[model samples]
Target chain A: MRAYGFRVPGGFHATHTYEAVEAAERIGYPVVMKIVSPDVVHKSDLGGVRLNISTAQGVRDAFDLMMLRINQRLPDARIEGIYVEKMVSKGLEIIIGMSRDPQFGPMLMFGLGGVFVEVMKDVTFYIAPITHDEAMQMLMSTRSYKMLVGARGQQGVDLKAIATGLQRISQLSTDFPQIAELDINPFIVGEFGTDPVAADVRMALQSPED
Target chain B: MLEPLLYPKTIAVVGASKKPGKVGHEILANLIKGGFTGKIIPVNPTADQVLDLPCYKSPVDCGESIDLSLIVVPNRAVVEAVKSSIKAGAGAIVVITAGFKEIGEEGAALEREVAEICVSHGVRLLGPNCLGLINTENRMNASFGGDIPMAGGVSVISQSGALCTAILDTAAGLNLGLAKLFSIGNKADVSEVDLLRVLGRDEQTKVIVGYLEDITSGDDFIKAATEASTIKPVIILKSGTTVAGLKAASSHTGVLAGADTAYGAAFMRSGVIRAENYEDLFDFATAFAIQPLPKGDRVLIITNAGGPGTMAADAVENAGMRVMSLDRNVATALKSKLPAAASVGNPIDVLGDADPDRYLAALEAAQEDDSVDAVIVILTPQAMTRPVETARAIVVGCQKGDKTVLASFMGGRGVLPGRDALAAAGLPQYYSPERAVAALKAMHDYAAWKRRPPRIVARFRVNTRRVERIITRCLRANRRQLG
Candidate 1:
């Protein structure tokens, strides 16, 4: 799920695994390569992720290294080959999630993305099928949102874009019954006025019976 | 006086037994032992006589009508007991049995049967599965539990029996009072919403506190709470906030929420002060019962030491209150009165070497300042700082000023003398700045909630047809499956 995230601009599960290298070459240089193995949830932790693969040879080498790393890291499971995609530049990272709660049902969570998600629980939630007003309210609830609004001469990220993205996930949850949770971390919210793109999308589907 | 319900004039233990360990014997013993000023009748069918009272075979044989009948029998037998109580002209019934809705599907059916019986007879049912209710106002101990609570101001309503006992035990140690306590278990018929609506109107109850794991009727609970909060503060310590907690609650009592965050947002919107922990729940309840509502969010800090005062200022700000800058004249007065080395700011730090007079002078000046809405006096142990005398001065200052006064005495045993002095004067004291700030914030929040226009959500009466369809679908899908 995490590996599928690096496949930027390509809708999830749209392209074949074997064509990923050719797709990256066709797309552009400075791409990222990650191992798409169900057994390895935290791919980055096990050295299954490699960034800045500028050439076709670089992609192949990184892919080979990732395969060897996964073999050593996860000996018992099957590997689903590798994923290759374009790399995104540094930008403000935000985390967005959808979780089903017993009390409130499905809820949309917004907070500062990346490792900060755990350390700083600076987050807010709005129940699914959220109104635009609720989506805006969720964005403003976090202290990090203040920072995103250009607190220190840093350009303010496009909040409307973030809200729209949140609304999409909320709608997705309502539409796709199998999608239990969707995590978009470090959704590189670009410099002021640019639409924020999902730098990574890790989605968990409910079991077939569920 | 609603004596029959709130302060029963006469009581009878319908299932009173000779067995020392049984609930029936314990209740009879509690009433007699607690000095209940009412006629007591022990009714037991199997025994000719019991508990030294005029033992009767049934409620019918108890001679005169009994005002309250406490039934502590098995689940299946409860329906008969309720019928007998109504037949005997008992005004109210306290049923202490477990095998009701709390047990499972079969028990829920039995609970509905019991409620139907109570409603038909026009008899008020306390619980089909409950620890029972107690009225401390007139010393009426109708609950089947063994413990007797201290009678005072704060009234508690808990959904869990064991939690009720815990609250009573905790209340006793804190020297808090109880006007009434209800353990509305299973809530098969009588619910928290009903009790809240009734208790909200009770004059004796200045503050209403609750420990609920699940809210059966969210709409009704919110309505009663919103109305009640207008008159008295309603403090709730809601459990089942986490995923695991919610699961545990479902197993304990069938409760499901769409999400926890929605509950949180609803709590805030409804003007209910949600306590983060058990201690805060009781602490805030105690503070609300004693302290006057703070007028505004602007607060003043006065301390014998600078560190604690500054810390308090930061905490106050964190609690959504502004630490007001002292008035120029007040700052000048404090500067002149204190040593030259002392900082003459909003937190008029009168150095560790300051005297009680200096502390009093700072507080007096701050109290009179129009900018300062409230005053937080910090007492840190030092070679010259007189904790007891300083506490007395602050208490006196509190009595004189319209502004609220809060104190934080930071040491251990050394702080106790000051704490005891504050307590004697009915002044609220905290062991740390964070606690003091939290208490002050709660006071401010309550005051704000009280002033706002009441937000009453129109009760959405269940659409029986729609609900029936959902239930039928659920039953057809699988009784064991829960989404």
Candidate 2:
């Protein structure tokens, strides 16, 4: 996805403990670690995700624990190595996604992420390859639009960054008809002047028959 | 040119019947009664004559080149009739036969085969289950429908044949004119987009009115409508939307984006004016078909009754248009000319006893005001009012102004003649104040659409080779929608 010029979190893949330590050093302290495997679907539930690992020793230990847990729980799962990414905690979380509509081709979706997403379910959509004004309208149409606008004394996120992220996904959606569904859940959006990052992403392509 | 299809020089009525109540007989009768001057040949296997016209055994046996073929044959004979028409060099074919695609799988297969044949030959096919079409300019009533509108500027395309007849009847009753009316039933070969493409180039059509149940192809429609709307206003009354019944599976964005969003976005992008309800279609059709595009959002209400006048003002505000306070000079001019009891403000009530002269003065005042973009003349037929005279005055008032006017002649019977006259004069007159205001707002919205900046669709660089490779694999696997 980063190859598409979408802003992903500063991250690296590591196969060994020494590489994990190297990755931590390169990304700096207070990093996040994740178990990368083909079979694992519920990462947090399977103790695959670890956040805020400060030292090089912490990174190595976390990587080893993840491998051991994976080996114990799901022996057939491929040990694809661990992921080390810079932890972004301060900014707001939003979801930007795309799914091909049967009649309308690719369509974009945007809204707030996390627990409230299920509870309130405020979102909006625009058919992809959306223009700047169209992207802006999508953000404004959502129920969580106030959050993006900075309600009360709270600071608003960089909406342009988010819109840009959405526009990139839109272009991707149009460019590749094969991508059946995609999601950038919890895209951490920084302050007005700061850049938003695609913290986690998933792309689901359709089967040949479908 | 749509000459062969819409303005054909001759027609062969296939399956032309001598029976009075049959579909074939009615179509042939309608063609003759409609004053179509072109040569009309009847195709019948049995009868020597159908409604006094010489009957040929089939289209192939017609000898003279057939321009249009109206097939009113049974399901089984339609294919043969179409082949015969093609052999006779027919440019277009209107299959008025049912049982194809409307019945079941066997019918769908039959329709598909017919559609394939039409596509291969590039024949302009209207329907396998429809009332066919009518072109008023050519004075052709190829359909069995009874209502044939007066010749004018609005071109109509309907999805349902039943709705097409109903709409034509309504238009006839209201004295609305039509340049072209097509009932594109099933739209197997030629869809709404195809009609829009043709209508876009029609010099006679000023406004395009469509009743669409579903868009056959969204991208094609967008492209066609965008081109059409740039030249002439396209007003569509799109119905049959199944609201977002799909639960939010992965994200909330899925929930917010309803089933209707695609249609709404497409309309917005293409500059197609969408009428919200069933009746709003005619309201918009009347406005775009007859009146000028309003210059701005400022509206002035001139009325005989204060209550209806106030209601019109409220509707104007609700429609996101402002009711303009009278210009000082215009207000002064109105005050000096009118009675002391009358109001000279936004809802310029001329009093119930006011007649044609008063309406003429108010309409002219609003027209002359720089702040007023459009005017809505509201009337409640009072005992003292002369409806016909006032209607004539309103028509004259419209002729003198650049700004468009919408009329609300509220009530039954007493104001029916006035409404009738206004409609005949091609002035959009609604039964309610709200309807008039709605039309006014549509005018304002259309103006806004015209003024909107052209959207620039941005292109971004991606790994084309990788994308191409993936697509190649998908295609190799015989997959259109890939994972």
Q: Put down candidate 1 lDDT per residue, B156-259, tens digits, no spaces.
A: 88988888888888776566778998988877667778877888899899889998888876557667777888788888888875452334221101122233
- Each candidate's interface RMSD: 12.9, 4.6
**lDDT tens readout by residue for model 2, A94-202:** 9988866667777788888986565776767677778887888789877678888898989988999888888888888887777766778778898988878887776
TM-score of 1: 0.71
Give the count of colliding residue pairs in each prediction.
11, 3
Q: Grade the docking of candidate 1.
A: incorrect
Model 1 per-residue lDDT at B285: 83
DockQ of candidate 1 is 0.08
Instruction: Report per-prediction Cα RMSD to one decimal.
Output: 7.9, 4.5
Residues B1-483, candidate 2: write the lDDT tens digits. 456889888899999999988999999999999999799999998999878888999888877998999999999988999999988998999999998888999999999988888779988788889988999987999999884678988899998899888888888877788899899987878789989999999988989999998888878888999899988999998887623324333323444455677677678778899999768888988888888999888889899888998899899898878988789999999898899999999799899999899999998888888899899998898899888899999999998878889998999999999998898788899999999888878778778878877677677676767766765775676543211
Classified by CAPRI criteria, candidate 2 counts as acceptable
